[model samples]
Every structure is written in C-alpha cells, then in structure tokens.
Target: MKNVYIETYGCALNKADTFIMETLLEKEGYKFVEKPEDADIIILNTCVVRLETEERMKQRIKELNKFSSNKKFIVAGCMSSAEPATVLSIAPNASLVGPQAVERILEVIKSSERKIILDGDKASVTPRLFEGKIAIIPLADGCAGNCSFCITKLARRKLRSYPLREIVESAKYAVLNGAKEIELTGQDTAAYGLDLGGTIRLPDVVSKVAEIDGDFMIRIGMMTPEQAMRILDDLIEVLKNPKVYKFIHLPVQSGDDRVLKLMNRKYTVDEYRQIVTEIRNKIPFVNITTDIIIGHPGEDEEAFNNTILLMKELRFERVHLAMYSIRPNTKSASLPQIPDSIKKKRMHIANKVYEDVAYSVHNEYVGTISRVITTELGRKGSVIGRTINYIPVVIKNENAQLGKWYNVKITEASFYDLRGVLV
Candidate 1:
C-alpha cells in the first residue's frame, strides 16, 4: 500500500471531506501516513474563508513542498477552487481539486499526473469516509447567499443538496457504527432542500433523522438569518424532537443596520433579535450562538457600539468572533478597510463583553443536572462533552468513555465551559 498524508483546514465540512478522501483512498490500498516526508502522496485540504487563511494555506504548501520534493501533492477544498490561479502560482506542480470534485479523488490519485481536478461530481458513496462514535455529515455544498466578505461563494459555486434518502441512510449508518453525535453541516444548513425546489426542507430532513431511534444527538449546523426567517416555523416544529439538540447557531454578522447593509447582509438587527427572541420563547433552555465580524468596512464607533449593545441584550451562549479580513474578489475588499489596530481594539472590547455576559448567564446554571455527549476523553481521564444546549462540560472521571451520553451534574461554571461530574 502506498502511504498518503492529508492535512485539513477550515470548517467541519472540510473536515468531513478530508474523512471521505481518507476512506476512499484507503479502500484503494493507500495507507495513511502521519508526516508528509514519509508519504508518497500528500493532500492539503485548504480553506479560503479570509485572505489570511488563504495566505496560510500557501505557506503550508511551501513548507510541504520542502518536505516531499519527490511526492505527488494534491490541493483540494475551498482555496483550491477559490483561487486556482494563485494556488497554481504557488505550486504549479501540484494537483488541485474542489469541494464538489471530491468523488473523483480515486481517479485523480490513480492517474499519477499533476492536474487541477474541479469536477462537481455528486457524492454517491453510501457510507461516509470517517464514521466514528461521532460523525459530521455535510448535507450540501455551496451556499445560497453571496455575502460581501465571503470567498467561499466563489469556491463553492452553487447550492447542491444531497438526496434526502442518502442523507438519512448515512445518518443511520453512523449511528449503527456507535455514533452518538451527528453534526449536520453545510455552507448554510438551514437553506437545505431549497435547491431541490420544495421536494423537501431542512425540517423534513431533521424529522427523518430524529425518527431513526438512536441514543445520539444531532446538531443542525449554522443558519443564516434569512434562511431561518424563511423556515422559522418549520424549524421550530422539527426542533421539538428530543433527538435533536436544543441549539441553533445563526451567524448574524453584525447587529448594526448600517454595518449589515455595508456587509451585504439581508436581515436587519431587529429581525435577528426577533428570531432569537422567538426561538427562546418556544424552546426552553435553548442555546443560541452567533458569528460576529468586529471591524467590517464602514463599521464606525456607533455601529460597533450597536453590535455590543445587541450582543449584551441577546446574551448568546457563544460568539465566534473574528476581526474582518479582506478577501480577494470580495465586494467589501475595495471599501474603506478598517485598520488592523482598530479592528483588534474592537475585538478585544467585544471579547470582554462576551465574557461578562456568558459568565453571568452561566452562573444561573449551577446546581443543574444536564445530559451531555462526551466527544473527547482528555488527558488523565478527564472527559470533555457538550451539553444539550451545546455548552462544553469537562468531567473529571476516569471511567468516562467518548461518545457516551452521561448525566453530568454541573458543580462549577465558567465563561467558556462548564465543570461537571458525571453521575
């Protein structure tokens, strides 16, 4: 068996793609290698979320180039397609593949040639590449929206939904294989099935997965406010299933209307607030998380203040904060760029606010018994799991096993995660 090494970047979707590639290549008698230097083939699954990420991908490629001068190098995922010319410029000798072209990995590897592979081949494999005690499944590729700062739109061109039957089957296979945590991922998970013209919807998919009686938890991925609003009622109904985790991650980007407009976001701050309010009203103890871009173009002090005020008001359980970075070919790239120093300052302030709010809010959860799915059994027998509300809970028990749902009593709480003992 020829040794192959793969390094992945970006979101869970990319991780899932890497797993698929690993499985496919392994079936064809390829052995997984840890280091690039020891492998005959090297794969870099790159990310193109921001300009810095793209640059980091190039840097990694350069470093790998030094290690495996005689090996076949393959670059795939968002960066390969988003900036094909740039990626090729960096490593003209390497083979490039896109997110949609993952199904062709076997053929590309067998060809023994250096060429760009960007086929939008539909994934036909029934079992996922990396099904474990916990699994992540991408329900779709590409996105329905074209946010100004997003280069993923260029990489993942169109929204392509996996057949509902195939997705449900995959979910069942994961569970049968002892998976207790199944994360349904995509560019915009809530926008699933819209590309199939009302044949099915996100709620229908969730309902099907929930019906597959497994002692596992399903996490529906991030939803855009626009998609959530479109199917808010349906989503609420689907979430009523106990099998689905009581959590929703919606990337609001910014809470200021001016900043929202400047970023080409479709929803207003009021609309986002209302969605959050409505979700909380219907679902008890529902954990809401969001993404925030701290210093976007034209995001003045007043706009930034609006964002802070709104986040304080909403008190999200977690906020994935990132200082806006310009990406090539993005509409926001040409706008008045915020200085790095100013962006860092805004991000620091936002971090402090989030810490204060999160700690204060989490303090109320002390002395509560929560059900958590242990995903990682850390060093010294400490198990780190996520509660039904998606808060990380660290359990100091030696007998804990990964992927088992346990009743953890919250004894202590922190701004970032919860400390609990598994009973």
Candidate 2:
C-alpha cells in the first residue's frame, strides 16, 4: 500500500471531490500520509476561479512535484480541464482529473504513466465527508451561466443536477453521521434541474432535505441573480423552514449596467437590488453576502463609484472583494483591461468600506443573547459557532463542545466574528 497525500483548494465542492477520492483509495488498501514529503503520491485538487488563484496553483504544483520519482502526481478539478497546457508545462507527468471526471480518480492514481480523465465520466454519491460538525454535499456540477469573465464554466461545462432522491438520501446519511451543518453546493445552485425536464427545482430539493428529520442547518450555495429570481417566491417560502439558514450569495460583479452588459452577467444592478429587497422583506434577519470584482474591463471611475454606492446601499453582511486580472481565452481577457494599480486601489477602497460596514453591523450583536451551534475549535482555546442567522461567533470558553447548542451572550465584536460568553 502506497502512502498518498491530498491537498485541495477552492470551494466546498472541490473539497468533496478530494474526500470522494480519498474514500475510494482507502477502500482499496491505500495508506494516507500526513505530509506530502512522506507520501508516494500527491494530489492537488485545483481551482481557477481567479487569475491570482491560478498562479498560486501553478507555484504549489511545482513545489509538490518534488516528492515523487515515478511522476505519480495528479492534478484534479477545473484547472486540469481548462488550463491543461499550463498544468502540463509545469508538471508534465501529472495526471488530470477534471470536475466531471472525479469518479475516475482511482484509474488516474493507479496508472504507471501520466493519465488524464476530463470527460465522459459520471459522478455518483459517495460517503459524505464530515469533520467536526460540518458536512458538504455537492448538489451538482457545471453552471448554466456564460459570463464572459468566468473560466470555470469551460471546465464544468455540463449542468448535471443529481437526482433529488439521491440528494435527500445523502442528507439523511450526513445527519445520521452527526453533521450539524450541511452545505448544498454547486457552480450555480439555482441552475439546478434545468435538464431534468423542469420537474424539480432548488427549493424543492431544500424542502425535501429539510424534512429529513435532523438538527443540522441547511445552507444554500451561490446562485446567479437572474436564475434565483425565477424561483424567488418558492425559494423564499422554503427558506422560512427552521432548519434552513436565511443566507443568500448573489454576486453582482459590478453595479454599473454597462460593465454588467460587457461581462454578460445577465442581470442589472436594479435587478440584483430587487432580489435582495425581496429576500430581506421576507427574511429580515437574513445574512446577505456578495462578491465584488473590484475591476473588470469597461469599468471606469464612474462604474467603480457606482459599485461603492451600491455596497453602501446594500449593506451586505459580508463582502468578498477580488481584484480582477486577465484569464486566457476569456472575452474579458481580449478587451482592454483595467490597470493593475487601478484595480488594487479600487479593491483597497471597497475593502475598507466593507470592513467598516461589517464592523458597524456586527457591533449591534453585542450584549445580545442567542443560541449557537458549536461547530469548530478556534484559536487560543476558543470554540466557533453560528447563530441561526449564520453569524459566526467565537466563544472563548474551553468547556464548549462541538455539535452542541449553547445559549450565549455576545460580549465583543469584530468584523469577522462575534465574541460570546456562555449564558
């Protein structure tokens, strides 16, 4: 039995892919290694969400390539599918297992020579991966959107929504295995069932899983604004369930209509606002998080300013800011890009606004009492938990137990988390 080391990057779905691979390998009598230096083989589950992330993956692959003599290196996920030339340029002997071909990891690992499995493979439900109190169930793969700035669609090119019954069964298995937080993830969660003859939608899946009789919380992953709006009424009704978290991730990309049109986002600033307004009207305590790419092609000073104004108006509970950089083969990459200096400046400014607003909003949690579910251990003997509305709280008490609910009084606040004391 050979020792294997696996490192994963990107979203929950990627993590799940790594877990599935590990599970299959372990079942076949392979050994797990704690460090890449000690492993006979190493796998890097990669992501290509941003240009910066792609660069990081390249450097990391180079560093990990040193551990093997037989070229027993594997690169998994979107980078393998979309950036095969770049990956091979660095680790020429590395095997590629694409997003759609993760089920073929065993073949990639066992072959004596370099192998690539990127297509004509199917994903089946494997054992759910749960650590501490969290479990991630990838609802499906691929996205329905064709945004000009996104390269991820090229990798996960098919919209394959898993069967609703299978998803429900996976949820049941997770709950039975003591998972306290279940994340329903995909490229576009709202794009679910577009190929299923319109029989089932995202809300139907959520509602079915909510009926699984568990103490776990259900988190819906990122969904396109336009796609989400189509199911808004039904989605809102299902989110009212006690087990589902009132959180929505809608990436507006930019606030200016011209920039959005250029990016092919399929939704305007006003349309994005309408989705938020509707969600907030029904679920007032909802935690609305958004992603903002600081600079994209066609974003002028006015466009950037419009984004800032929109952020102020939305007052998102959390804002994930990224400075745009060019990616190959994308329409935006062919256009005149915003200067790196300008992108950095806008990112810094937007980040400051995001931090200030987040701090102000979090400060309101001070002196409030709420019940939180202990999910993870944090720094300096602290325990991490989430409020019903999904506000992360760090309880500095050593007595807190994972997966248990505790009523606590928030005594301090930071932009990232709230400090709570057991009540």
Candidate 3:
C-alpha cells in the first residue's frame, strides 16, 4: 500500500472533511502516515477564513513543493476551492479538490495529474474515523447563506445533506468504537436537509442520534440566525436532549442593524437578539458562545459600541473575536476598508469586553459541581477536561485517565478556564 499523510487546517468542519478524505484514501489501498517525509502522497486540507490563514497555507504549499518533485502533493479544501488558480501558481504541479468533492479524492490520489479541480457532483460517502474519543458526523456540506465577508461560497457552493439513516449509522459505528462525543458539523448545520428530498431538518438528525443508547454527547455545529428562526421550536427541543451537550456556538457578526445589512446577513439586530433570548429562555443552563468580527469596512464608533453593548447584555460564555481582513473574492473586500489604527483600537476594546464577559460567566460556576469528561492530564497536578456545557475545567486529580468521566466541584474560576476538585 502507498503511504499517505494528511494535514488539516481551519475549523472542526475542515478537520472532519480531512478525516473523511483520509478514510477514502485508506480504503483505496493507501497507508496513512503521520509525517510527510515518509509518505508517497501528501494532502494539505486548507482553510481560507482569514487572510492570515491563506498566507500560512501558501507558505506550507511552497515548503511542500520541495518534495513535490518526488511525491504526489494534493491541495484540498477551502483554499483549493477559493483560489485554485493561485494554488496552481504556487505549486504548478499539484492536484486540488474543493469542499464538495469527496467522491474524487481517491481518483486524485491514484492519478499523477496537475492542476486538477475536482469540485461539485456531490454524493454521500460515509466518512472513516481514524482516532480519538469524539466522532464527527458531517450531516451536511456547504452553506446556504451569502454573508458579504464570507469567501466560503467560492468553495462550498451548495448545501447538501446526507441521508438521515446513513448519518445515524455512522454515529452508531463511531460510538461502538468508543467515541464519547458525536459532533454534527457542516458549514451551516441548521441549513441541513433543505437540499434533500424531504423536510427532515437538523433537529430530526440530532434527536435520532441522541436516541442511540450510549454515554456520548452530541455537539451541533454552526447555525445561521435565519435557520434558527425557521425551526425555533425543534431547535429548542434538541437543546433539551440530555445526550446533547448544553452548549451552542452561534455566529452573530455584528450588533448594529446597518452593519448587518451591509454584510447581507438577512437578519436584523432585534431578530438575532430574539433568537438568542429564546435559546437562553428555553435552555437556561446552556453555554452560549459566538464569533464577533470587529472593524468591518463600514463600522464606525456607534456600530462598534452597539456590538460591545449587546455582548455585555448577552454575557456570552466564550467569544472568538477577529479583526476584519479583506479577501480577494469577498463582496466586502472592494468597499473602503477601515483604517488600521481604528480597527486595532476596536479589536482591543472587543477583546477587553469579551474577557470581562467570560470572567463574569465563569464566576457563576465557582460554587457549582459538574461532570467532566477527562481529555488530558495537565502538566502540573491538575487534570483537564470539558464539561457537558463545553466549559474547560482543570481539576486536581493525579489518577484520572484521558478518556474517563468524573464529577468535579468548581473551586475557582478565571476569565479563560475553571479550576475544580475531582468529586
């Protein structure tokens, strides 16, 4: 069997895609390798979320080019989808595949071709899980919405959902293999099943997975506000599932309606607030987290202030804040960009606010006891693990194994993590 090494970058969805691709290659008589040096085939699963991420991918491609003279190098994922032409320019002899082309990975690996663009013609293929305590079931591919700053449209062109039965079987297989977490991932998870023949919906998928008797937790991936509003009742029911983790990672780009409109997000500030309010109202103990981009092209002080105010009001348990950067094909890239100084200042403010919000939320857990699924043993005497609500807790336990479950009592809290005692 030919040796293959796959490297992944970007979100959990991308990581899941890499796993799927690796599975396909392995079935085609390829042996998986940990390092690129010993492999006959090297695949870099790319990301294009930020300019920096794309640049890093470029650097990697260039470095990988050194060995390309002797081995088969493949560039797959978002960077390949968004900038196939540029990728060709950098590694003039490599093959490429977009997010939509899972069926073609085996063919690409078998062939000795250059500048191959294997995109579209979507089909359902059950992905292979190689390792770990978590099983990522990609229920859907691509995204339905066109947020102005997003370049995902270049690669993840259409939203396609897998058959509900297929996804459920995949979850069962993973659980049988000792996976304690089953994460449902996609570009827009809530947009699942729209392209399928029926109106099955995302919650239906989650409920089905939860029905499987096990000690596993289900984590739902990113969802747009539009989808959330459409299936509010079903979503609420899914959140109430005991097998499902009590944490949601939602992206609310900005707080001002005008900025949201410019980004073509299709939802108003009030609409977003209502969705979040409903989620909180129904799942009171749920840990709500979000992604916030500071200093978009037209964000002035007032718009920035609105974001800060809303974040303070929501008290999001966690926030991934990024300073906006222009990408070539995105609609927002052509607009008059924000000044660097102003953007930096806004980012600083947003970071401070996010830290404060995180601290406040953490403080509430200081006296509470929660069950932790141990993931690692810390460098010191502490054991680190994640709670069902997705909170990272470090407990002083010297004997806990990596994949064991234990109850922990919160002893202290910080802005970034929590300290607990194993119960």
Candidate 4:
C-alpha cells in the first residue's frame, strides 16, 4: 500500500476540501501517515489568503523537498489556482491541483509526471464519510463580492451553491457516522443561492440541516454584511433553533464608511451597525465574533479612531484582527500602501482594544452555569467543550467522550477560555 501525508492550512472551507481529497485518496488504497517523512507521497493543501501564508507555503515546500527527494509531492488548493507559477517555482516537479479540482486528486496522484491541472469546475456536494466527530460541510465554492484587497476572488471567481437537498443529505450522513458538530462553510455563506437566482437562502439551508435527526451542533461560517442584510430576519429565526450555535461571525473589515467604500465593500458602517444591533437584540447573550483589518490603504488617523470607537461600542466577544499586507495583482496593492511601521502601530492599538474588551466579556461568564458539549481533548488530561453560545469551557477530565453533553458550572474565566466543572 502507498503511504501519503497531507498538510492543510487556512479557513474551514479549505479544511473541508482537504477532507474530501483524503476521502478520495483513501478509497484508492492510499494509507495516510501522520508525518511527511514516513510517507511516499506528500501533499501540501496550501492557503494563499495572506502574503505571509504564501511565503510560508513556499518555505514549507522548499524544506520538504530537502527532506524527501524520492517522494512525489503534490500542491493543491487556493495557491494552485491563484499562483500556480509561484508553486511551480518552489517545487518544479510537483503536481498542482486547484481548489475546484479536488475530485481529480486521484488522477493527479496516479500520474507519473509533473502536471498542472485547473478545472475551475463547479464544486461537488457528494456525501462522503469523514473520520471525525466534527464534520465540515462546504455549502459552496467562491463568493459574490469584489473586494479590492481580496486575492481569493482570483482563485474562486464565481458563486456556486450546492443543492439544498444535497446539503441536507450530507448533514444526515455525517451525523449518522458519529459527527457531533456540523460546520457549514463557504467563501461567503450568506451569499449562498445567489448564483441560482435566489431559489434558497443560507437561512433555509441552516433550517433544513437543523431538522436532521441527530445530536449535533451546526456552526454557520462567516458572512458578509451585505448578504446578511438581505435575509437578516430569516437568518435570525433559523439561529433560534436549538441545534444551531448562537455564534455570529461577521467581518465588517473597517468601521469607517470611507474605508469600507475604498475596500469595495458594498455596505456602509451604519448598515453593518444595524445588523449587529438587530442580532444582539434578538439574542442578547449570543457570542458575536467579528473580523477587522487595520492599516488598509487610505486609512487616516480619524478613520482608524472610528474603528476603535466602533470596537468599543460593539464589545465583540472575539476579534479576528489582521494587519493589511500587499497581495500581488490586487487593486489595493496598486494603490498607495501603508507604511509597515504605521501598520505595526495600528496593530498594537487594535490588540490593546481587543484584549480589554475580550477580558471584560469573558469575565461576565465566570459565575454562570453553561451546558457544554465535549468537542475535543485538551492539554494535560483536560477536555474542551463549547456552550450553546460557543464559549469554550475546559474541564480537567481525561475520560471525557467526544459528542457527549454535560452541564458545566463555570468556575473561572480567562481572556481566551473558561474553566468549568461538570455538574
């Protein structure tokens, strides 16, 4: 039997793609190994969302080449589609496959010579069994936005949502196969069904998945403010289902309308604020998470301060903060760039605001009793679980089974996690 090792990076959608690739390869009699050194074939499921990530992928490919000269290397994922030349430059002999070409993984592996393949076909939604308690179901490939700073648009150029029936069936298969969590992922989950002329929306998809007969939590991935506004009422109604996690991941990007316009985001700051306010009003204790990009092009002092003020006003439980870096071929890259020193300074300020708000929010849950589902094993004989609102609770128990629910009493809280004891 041939041995293969696969390493993946980036978002949940990319992780789902890796899982699909593995399922395909395993059926072809390939034995998966934990380490690259022990395998005859090594695959790097690459991510190119950030400039640093692309550089890291290059470094990793170079290092792997030195470690195993005889092994066949395969490069797959977003980098394969967006920057195939750079991938080839790093590993000339490696077979390259794009994100949409995941179903063709077996073909690439069976080939003896180096080949560059990019089908750019619509994504497939065939149900496949995964060997884990958490099953990531990608609802679609690509998005509808044309953000100036986004490089992913170059790779996944169109929005192609999976059939609602297919998605529901996939969720059923995953739950029946022992999955405790069903994570619905996509480039922009809220933009689902747009390409199909709005026959269905993300809320409808979530409601169908929640109706599946199983003990699992459904985690809806990131959604843009523009799309979310279209079906905000329906989305909130679906979120009220007990099976759905009360976690909202909305990426506002910038808090100033001028910066938002410059980034090509369709919504204004006031619109984003209204969406946040409505969701909060409906679910007061919901864990609201957001993404923020600092030091983007044309962000002046006042604009940056506006972001800080919005962060303070919103008090987001978690912030996915990033410093803007130039991506090749992106419109933002061609414009006037921000100085690295200023970017670093802005990042520092954002970090301080995030830390203050995060600590304050987590402190509120210290004395509350939360029902948590044990999701993963943690450090030093501990198990980690998540509350309905998706707050992570760590308990010191070695024998905790995955997918089991427990009523945990919150004993302590930290900046990032909560400590609880099972009741």
- Over 1-423, each residue of candidate 2 has an lDDT whose tens digit, in order, gives 898988999988888777778777887888888888788889999999887899899999899877656538898888999999999999887888897888788888888778988874445655455566787787788878888988888888888888887788778988999999988988789988987877799999999999988688999998889899989999999889999988888888898999999999988899999999999999999999898888899999999999999999998889888888787888989998888888988888999999988999899989999889988889999999999888899998999988999999999998888999999
Model 1 per-residue lDDT tens digits across residues 258-299: 889988888999999999989999997899999999899999
Off by over 4 Å in 1: none
Per the 3 Å backbone cut-off, how many clashing residue pairs does candidate 4 have? 0
Q: Candidate 3 clashing pairs? A: none
Global lDDT for candidate 2?
0.87
Q: Report RMSD (Å) for each prediction in the order shown.
A: 1.6, 1.4, 1.4, 1.6
Ten residues in sequence with the least summed lDDT for candidate 2: 120-129
lDDT of 4: 0.88
lDDT scores in order: 0.86, 0.87, 0.86, 0.88
Give me the displacement of residue 46 in model 1, in angstroms.
Answer: 0.6
Top candidate when judged by lDDT against the true structure: 4
Provide the global lDDT of candidate 3 against the true structure. Answer: 0.86
Task: Kindly list the per-residue Cα lDDT of model 3 for residues 302-416, writing each as its tens digit.
Answer: 9999999999998899998999999888899999999989999999989999998899889988888888887656778777888888888998878776677888899999888
Q: State the number of backbone clashes in model 2.
A: 0
Better of 3 and 4 by lDDT: 4
